[model samples]
Target: MTNGSPSESAISPGKPGQSTAVHVRDVTMDFGNGALAVSNASFELETGKFLTILGPSGSGKTTLLRMIAGFETPTSGEITVNGKPVDSAPPHRRSIGMVFQKLALFPHMTAAENIAFPLKMRRFNPKTIPGRVDEFLDLVKLGGYGNRRINELSGGQQQRVAIARALVFKPELLLLDEPLAALDVKLREEMQLEFRRIQHELGVTTINVTHDQREALVVSDDIIVMDGGRIQQHAKPVDLYRAPDNAFVAGFLGVASFINGHAVPGGLASGENFLSGTHAGDFADGTAVRGAVRAEQIRIAAEGGQLTACDTRLTGTVRDTIFEGERQLYVVATEEIPGITFRIYHHDPESFGLFEIGTRVMIGWNARDMKIFESRAS
Candidate 1:
């Protein structure tokens, strides 16, 4: 139903059920005969869910989004929307809405006029345009500001207006390509929450492309982490963060330390030190493997423990220390492992605050906390 203003009812359509909204099957995109921009990428988008393509620069996220938007066609494979083949369909006919990095609002138009532009193109009744505009403005929380000029509104307000305008057409899918990237840090964060709220309220299927991991984790129901044009992992935010599939995935998500060790009778052996834990992958006895541990997982203890039965412990010297407001970070150089450095995160006084640079210390962690990956040969 239309609200007091045409913009008031400009809610994103509710999400559909388990039925797929967009499907990319074995899609690949290449420029001329050169390198591939998207290499055999494939994924399914559920109706009403938010899926984010996350990666570093040149990872082909934008190109993949463009393909979904009908701005660029895949070199091979098929794309379907709502069970219908859309590979040959033109953008306007595909029933989709897009918001770019730049808001792309008309400078000369009032907020109401800008929101009404899409409806006008659809040949909507002129008499009904005002009501629709008012409905959408209210929905975007800009109900009374319809008459304000584009330049008159703040950056955030302009963003809401752009969103309202795109939704005015009521497309089946929405594609946002880092729409908040241009805003200031605070504004970007605020907009991220606002967009998520709006998306959930409307339940429309969405595909967002961003290089910011935090942004992706905060806004997405499922995240696709990409590297070198290939998807490294697709999982819920918590799973990807806690249990990364590989060394690259582990390091990319946050700070980590890699330690090399050889498999022994009881556990893994590194020089004179042995760490006990269940092995993760297939590795024969005496085979060398690399173990990774997050900074927060490494525990620091005062020297001279009775070598009690613990997971793993190594004696080391505090090479450097840095105080980070709430947490203390220490770079320790160990005698059992030379040239190998360990980072420890200390937040409590009894745990981390007592350590100082040049102090002798012992670092240890539970075997379960350490992730062992198959070592690659040089």
Candidate 2:
């Protein structure tokens, strides 16, 4: 695992009723026998903002979320919710609403009953429970679903019930742990939008953990990418995708292609070809480096086609082609790099000719679209 610095320090605790929604400072978790799950993680979340912790399995995203939810205590460091330390507070006293990967709805309860469970458990006014249930049903667009049993609803409806249940009691913070992971792709996308809508409507400060990149991008105001027990990069969705801090974040976030080369004055060089790119890291001349480019950023054309606008150009043979519905992916074997193949995406397949296997073509991209980083396995 690569070591990474914490993205940001916790925001200073604010005056009464003005604290950051969540603040985790230098939090580390280690099991016995050197099983370290998370290391030196720190970030601040503002009120009414949505943050997604994105990473692959075993990346410690879930463990971090569990710590915030008070399910597990951090081995070191401090966690604060609304300016109060919560390391020793039990889950029920933390005023947090959670939606787990599994719906966890009571099988025998009706949808309305499910939503009302939290309120009843919290000892809300008995006379107000029915009206509150109706209001929450409307919030999740599940009005009139109170009479239907859990088994009678569709999967998406069941999901709505779970969300409504979590929010009905009006917790100060919401934590979602891969709630849409089990849904079908289409439903999951739809629910991603629904989650955004509900969050905005209620103005809830939320933290969600997911391995799905698309879900994180679609739903988050900011994203924190975790890997190998460390915080990698924390930024808005576009910045995280376009300006990754390292090779791991770039590879994890999108369909990235890398070319190994040594650092030149402003870019990288592979054999006789000099590739122009942009970078933010300190790389001395002659240092081993790699150029990273997204597949969609490169444009491909037949030989002799005009590419005067591109900063870097290369000639290659189309080694493979994949026809997705909206775009076509081409794998090009370039002469400049002996064993490496460049993956390029053509979005307007209907407008451009599809270069079949073995067809000679030219590929080009602007230097700004490619980023140079220290060579390492992503």
lDDT of 2 by residue, 80-138 (tens): 88878875566666678999889899998999989889888888888878887887788
Each candidate: RMSD: 3.4, 7.0
**What TM-score does prediction 1 earn?**
0.86
lDDT of 1 by residue, 1-378 (tens): 434432244333433666788899998989775778888989998888899998888888898898888788889977887777775676666678888889899999999999999889888888888887887788789989999999999999999998888777777788899888889889889888887987877777889999888898899998888877778788888898888776666777767888888876556778877776556666788887777788898888779854354578889999898888678888999888787898878776545346778999888888777777667674
Worst 10 contiguous positions by lDDT, candidate 2: 1-10
Off by over 4 Å in 1: 1-15, 32-34, 260-272, 276-289, 305-310, 348-354, 375-378
Candidate achieving the largest TM-score: 2
Task: Please report how far candidate 1 places residue 192 from its true position, in Å.
Answer: 1.6
Model 2 residue 30 distance off true place after TM-score fit, in angstroms: 0.9
Error of 2 at 335 (Å): 0.9
